[model samples]
Target: MMEHSVIFPDHRKVCALGQGTWKMGKSALREADEIDALRAGIELGMSVVDTAEMYGNEEMVGAAIRGLRDRVFLVTKVLPGNASRTGTKAACERSLNRLKTDYVDLFLLHWGGPHPIEDTVASMIELQQEGKIKAWGVSNMDVPEMERFYAVPGGVSCAANQILYNLAHRGVEYDLLPWCRERHLPVMAYSPADEGRLSRNPVLMEIAQKHEATPVQIALAWILRCPGMIAIPKAGSVTHVQENYRSLSIRLTAEDVDLLDGAFPPPVRKVHLDSW
Candidate 1:
């Protein structure tokens, strides 16, 4: 099995595997199951919960971690549209009210937007000072954007960078991942399994058979193998969540890594970061 935790530049630690709530709380019929799935994942030590105001599910997350908040390392995001200094503060208040928590462990700018990065960075610093958030970061930032982010005041305090990374999308591995690693910033990978597409790959299937695991688990294990990388995969049911948790126990041999790398070649040149 691989290591289970990643440390930020400032030395904060979080689970390598986390729960993603991209389209959560969108269906009343599946709400109970989704909440149960998140709780089950938390019980299994995947306590880094990732959601956002954009996902429209902070209230559901609030309900799932209701009595168990202290056990969670909660993470959420502010929409890019509301990333101005004042807008950021207003967004945090709304997120806090929806999450039913006094403070979010980490808050992120959903993505680069019209607002100046300096303004958002200033706002994030202020929020930390007020104890409204423990730390702040960004999502969907490529290397150029990240460089620009670092150029601004207070940008060095960015704790992590969340991105779309998986076996299928290794473009970030070329430059973005290394750039963050150089700065000691952890990367929180959203859609790490490519929304289950990797589950059908014949190569992953062959490898999973050798390990007596599912192809999706192999995909997740590949992501977990990297240092300073975190994967947040959405599981809408308890069984799915348990399957994802089991990936942490998988140990892919060197040959297995080679086979996966051969099947899904890493990028040799920088490419645009994929966001969904």
Candidate 2:
């Protein structure tokens, strides 16, 4: 639904609305359905697909986006445990193979694991040189931690930061969001619907009534309304993905925002990051 693009340091345009794939491969019972959901979303213009080695579903994602690889902006992560200079390269190679692609549009450090940020970042740089990943970033970061992340040599090249952010969990607004804003770095908000916990809010329901849309749309609209944001809500069915895609066209008015703000107020003080 987003016509404009968020340019990475390498000058590639990143789509704003995406599909998150967490707990996607943890079960085999629904593999085909999950792949259908992904392919459906991509067909509907939600081309950015975010996954991680930690999610255990790169193979499924690779299958779903098989023929549509170039149309989608693929993102995957290496676990912190695998962040060593050698480990990062190896892990990325494995991910690339599993993804059935030569390279990923964006690659990330899944979290702040035991590895030194320098070693991990250096490895990411190497992978970029070898064209394994076009750009790299970190996930689940706080403002202070991200500051320390960039302080490392070549750390300033981080293209984006993925974190748990949603209407119900607005903790990043207190600091992290503004930090990325100043630097023009896109903040990829995983679990943008609070893992599907936001659709039942009474206020969201009331607003949805006014817009003639579902509460899910109102919840996602709030996140996309913000500047420099990319919201990825996972879908396991084609219907769900289509619903998310339709949210892109739901533009909230100032009054709609004010009412929702009072119901689910923004954080005035810092709160801890909420994760899956």
- Using TM-score, give the best candidate's number: 1
Would you list the clashing residue pairs of candidate 2? Answer: none
C-alpha TM-scores of all predictions: 0.98, 0.96
Model 1 poorest 10 in a row by lDDT? 1-10
TM-score of 2: 0.96
Residue 106 local lDDT, model 1: 93
* Per-residue lDDT of model 2, residues 1-276, tens digit only: 456346666777756788999888667888899999999888877878999998888999999999999889999999989999899999999999999999998999988888889999999999899988989999998888799989999899898999988777787888889989999888888888777778888988998998888898888888887877888989999999888877878889999989977987899998887766
Total clashes, candidate 1?
Answer: 0
RMSD (Å) of each candidate, 1 decimal: 1.1, 1.3
lDDT of model 1 at position 95: 97
Top of the candidates by lDDT: 1
